[model samples]
Target: MRLKILLIAISLAAAVPASAQTSRFSPALLDRPDVKRALQSVDERATAIVDEWIHLVEIPAPSKKEQARAAYIRAEMQKLGLTDIRVDDMSNVSGVRKGSGGGPAVVFAAHMDTVFPEGTPIKVSREGDILRAPGVGDDTSNLMAVLEMFRALNRANIQTNGDLIFLASVQEELGLLGAKHWLETSGYKPDMFIAVDVGADDVWYGALRITQFKFFYTSPGAHTMESRGGPSPAKAVARGINALYNIPLPPIADGLGSFKLPVVNVGMLGGGTVFNAVPREAWFTVDLRSLDTPTQDRLTAAVTAAARNAANEEGVGFRVETQMGIDYTKAQPKQQRLDHPLVQTALAVANHFRKPGTPLIAPADVGSTDANIAVSMGIPAVAIGAVRERLPHRLEENADASSIVPGIKALISLAVALTTR
Candidate 1:
């Protein structure tokens, strides 16, 4: 089945039929003189975007706390004179670029939240040409990238047969809630969803296809001292852990992209009290993830079965719960390969600076971002980063200022290329 996007409740200059205002360049994008000029123009206007990027990065938008950042993006969209700017109830911020011809709605998005906590010091520091801060590259760069891309598209007067929607979305850090919300319920139907995140340059271009999970095990707790033979919810949890460890993991030779077996991190647990008493409640969160759905499904079943068996054998009540996960595996609107016109265009624009290669596409990064959500929804999505990496997610995270312009140039060029059609 094909996936569609929804865009709701916004004052449009005028509603143009989707067919009349949209265009889709299949096979590949045809390079035009305007595209070349726009790329050059983007390079020339790097400073303004870079300054703006740093400013936005300075605001901490952690997970559900994305209101401030969403407002920031909305203001930028409004400032750019974008029409029909709206911030949804879920806090997804979007702006539309009106088109003159029939064109599909191509979504352009950047995540609003970071993994850092609220009030984390977002103060950017300049050491030589490097820009340092907690959320500098993870997504702060992307937030500014989306806004600047719109600016360049406007400045170049590059009009496409498609309506380009710019989104500053929230809750990406938590199961891609914001992107999922837009994909599931919006007034605008999108033909494609382009997500800009983590500017890793060209060291890598592909994003991971992952299925995140939260497995829980529950059983009536028994006195550790009196019920030594029966199943202690904790023990069944242990068996679940063992089952997760033994769960069949995808082989490295699968060629279907790298995979991570259920990480099986026991996030939290509850049961029992002090003074030698048998507790009646126990629960724990299990994290499972992989590139393939079957792999994740099999693993989930194995853990459940293990928990169930242990509970039955020990004579106690047991159940499993799914905290959350992507509904599907691959990012939606498939055909998001590196050779896709969009990816290729992004590559061309990035060439003025760097090339994403193997290390950046390392097996470790498995769609742990908003890009994952888009991919699952059948949208063509890719995540990128700027200024390189070191100390990301740490108190010492940083990016080079000299490299910032190049990164900005890359985003502008890619945006211009994608929208030029």
Candidate 2:
């Protein structure tokens, strides 16, 4: 009798469809009335947000020179009625939204600086639905998204359970110096962090470890005839570059939890002036990256040793220095775990906004972002952008205008969900 009952139950269960299963927490958030209103508001303001993007991009905000953009963001945040607004020494502008219910604090930040140097033309061109300009999509889209989210939240009058801090960070293109200084100096410690950058549909939970080194070679200069026995700084720099490029890299792991292989590249090299003269000084920059921190450290050591040895061979002064002329070279922090609530929430919310059978982001597609500072300090953090962009760090960078609405919607939903938690 018991066996018959169990078999009958199993047969009945098999008749149920996949759609009948319980909805995920992330997808269910969309069903709330307030969330729906917020999404609609974002959609309504999408065009205005693009206008804001063009305006912001036109402002010159290169790394370490974000004063103009910072002031602009500060004024906008003030207009949005954010409290305790402040700009730090690094030009990191931030504002706070106090929650009615006491819960964790969450920060949403987008960098204000662009990879383009000062004086780069940021004029926008419209071709059909696409908007083109220097730094248009790399981060201008994200900065606008954050601004619009703040506006929508106020317009919709949606109150969260936790405090929300909105930020327009500076110096992100200069190795995340702005974020690092702000994190160390600011007394506010949020439970979760979301860094807006790069892409809206795609998410990055894991922050890749990075180490940049600038090798400077120096020697007494002489003409080719007089410098036959003298050390050559240029030759030393070349030897170091060759050794770094030839260093063997481990294969990327394909396991469920493992990350991809490390990478090392010499991004810039500068040396001699005249062809017939032995240059007195030469310099080269190396950017080393790894998903694993220990591996990154090991590889950094190897590169440093290689450069120093090469310098010794050429009898030139080879000093290991930082790329930014800082007292110590900066390194990327540890990655966020896939299972962390912040990361999982971001992934689920991203998938919720995408079409069926489309993967918005994955744990393995990690990159360096401002969230690296938070993640390094054991804080839950994830990096996202306002929309899909093309030709980042180039003059032709652009983003899909249609994606902005959904992108901002996802950001709002994610913020609400994290705050409620």
Candidate 3:
């Protein structure tokens, strides 16, 4: 009976037309007078938009320290005349553009935090169409773009059937904390969620399983001469890291660009306070990711066991703490999520505005953005980019200065498309 059910499901999936799934978004929507005016507004304010983007990028918004950016976004939200504007305790800023009612409520989110520290220089440099800075492209560019998209909607007095909520999420770089807090506690429950936090050419419809662990090894401190044959936390840390890497990883999933999946990386390590002594404690962090839950669970168990085993072998005390563990129990099935209008509409609208001669935008099944929180909650969500950016989370990060013009226009169209339908 289970085989029969599986066969029937496969046949039903095969019978559905691709066009039927993406029919909610039509290019004709872009031809409407209001949308046309909104698109034109982006072109007219192109220079100002880029300037604002650069200025926002220059503001340091390290994770959990986004007050400056939050203030700016809140003020801008007020300027847009949005209703129910709020700055949550976690620094997440959100406002609503109320629609005529009876249509789905949508939330468009873009993170305001970057991976760089507070003292890092964030001044943006421009050489023709390229803009370079520490946080230029990752989500600063998208934050600027989403702000402009809202401004353009107001410029044309465009109204839709459903309300649009603009969310400037904080601490997204710290494992989507701000978004998770807001989504869980906020009184509003949106029907669809869109995270404008990737490149304009890509769309992500699924959330990857991500777990972060910080393991510590402890022992009594000792002088260098006395440390001989004694259990050393530093040595235990080394052995544990080695064992973690030696643990077998599942085969890498395909189609994720430049990312090797089912992988474990030891991202940070620190130990001794002095060179002449064995430290009392040493610790390392592990970031593990996979495309599926079973693989993620298996690897997570292996990682913990390896750390404990190393501590045992080295005769040191060991304890592990989870830094980030996202629950996916309420997540929708794969086929149901893929067939949702939220994902299909985003794909259609994104590809419609993609640069000419570029390959068609395809939706990937991986996500590392704030949308992951929404996906885990069974909310219809998709993550799409707002600019062509490179070298994210690096000092050399940069984006095309001119790509944002069309990117904003695309955002305008997406907002209108999703809300009106």
Candidate 4:
């Protein structure tokens, strides 16, 4: 009779569509005694959180060179009494807050690397609510917020049924390499993944199809006097760039604020020893993105063809190298991903704690985050932000210093709600 009952329960669960299983998150969870204490702790330590944010931003954490920041995060993880702390070869730091069992494991990830190079100035400047610095808002603010979230949980002795893993990833700006490595190599497999790397007002549930390429044009050398008549890699580069831009793009996808989709951009260009000679080689990088695979493939072909055509027309040799390539064959279906409880639960929790008077938050079907790695692996994941950051990857990047208090509280609530459920 027990065996029959177990079979019946399994059959019943399988009968329900994934979309019907809604998120278990509730605003009422915030009122629980332990949760209330955690929120209060954030309020009490708001000043220190901002101060640490400033200090962390100042640390030079350029991609593939995040040792300093990784050490700091590992030390903080130890201070929080988190177990199984590990700093991987790629400088990805992870620690586990063990739970009481009977719930899903959730990973909260924030990248540590910034786009700025090592020598870039990152001294944070504060003006009332705004804090400006090179790496201040991008992932640094979110990294600090996640740390505080862990601290607040410990402060209240909040325990859930499932484990919570905090991951401070590196090389995110170089194409989510650290996350991809950790998820593939780490022995643990999480039931849900949350990348805390966007602005507080934004929630992204879909992974954008992104492909980056570096196209090189090469030609035999020529002196300044003979350069005009000889094949020039520089001229081929100029032509290739102009032709790539001429490729007709599909209409931009809607609901992505200020981000035009199905777009191609030349982000980097250079290659010459001196200006007087016809360069032997010139190269430029193309960052192409689209909302879906078909569009991305079509554009990728067009971009490469345009580059090759330029090389042929200019009588210059050409080659292409892929800088970042994502394989989406293992990704979940669109509706299945959108309907998953992880995304819905995050939406509910984020909206509940969102700043008043802001527009209702909606999950955008777009992402260029470490969560993209999880999405491609068919894991349930969503990307959300901890603060209202702006101008990411620019020298003037800034975020609202006052917004972090609520942000930490929101993270606390989300972690408790998801893991306890």
Per-residue lDDT tens digits for candidate 2, residues 186-262, read: 88888888898857656676667778898999988899889887789999998999988888887865532333458
lDDT string for model 4 (1-421, tens) is 9999999999999898443477667777888999999999899988989999999999999999999999999999999999999999888999999999999999999999999988998899999999999989889999999999999999999999999999999999999999999999998899989999999988899899999999999988789998767788998999999999899999888999888998999999999899788889999999999988889999999999999999999999999998778888899988888888888888887888799999889888999999999999989999999899899999988999999999888888889888895
Worst 10 residues of 1 by lDDT: 18-27
User: What TM-score does model 2 achieve against the real structure?
Assistant: 0.88
On residues 54-102, what C-alpha lDDT tens digit does candidate 3 reach at each position?
A: 9999888999999999999999999999999999989999999999997
Runs of candidate 4 exceeding 4 Å displacement: 1-21
- Candidate 2's error at 200, in angstroms? 2.4
lDDT score at residue 293, model 4, on the 0-100 scale:
88
* Candidate 3 lDDT trough over 10 residues, lowest sum: 16-25
TM-scores across all candidates?
A: 0.75, 0.88, 0.96, 0.95
Residue 27 alpha-carbon offset, candidate 2, angstroms:
2.6
Give the total clashing residue pairs for model 4: 0
lDDT of every model, 2 decimals: 0.62, 0.79, 0.92, 0.92
- RMSD values for the candidates in order, in angstroms, are 9.9, 5.3, 3.1, 4.6
Model 2 weakest lDDT span, ten residues long: 325-334
Candidate 3: Cα lDDT at 355: 96
**Residue-level lDDT for 98 in candidate 2:** 82
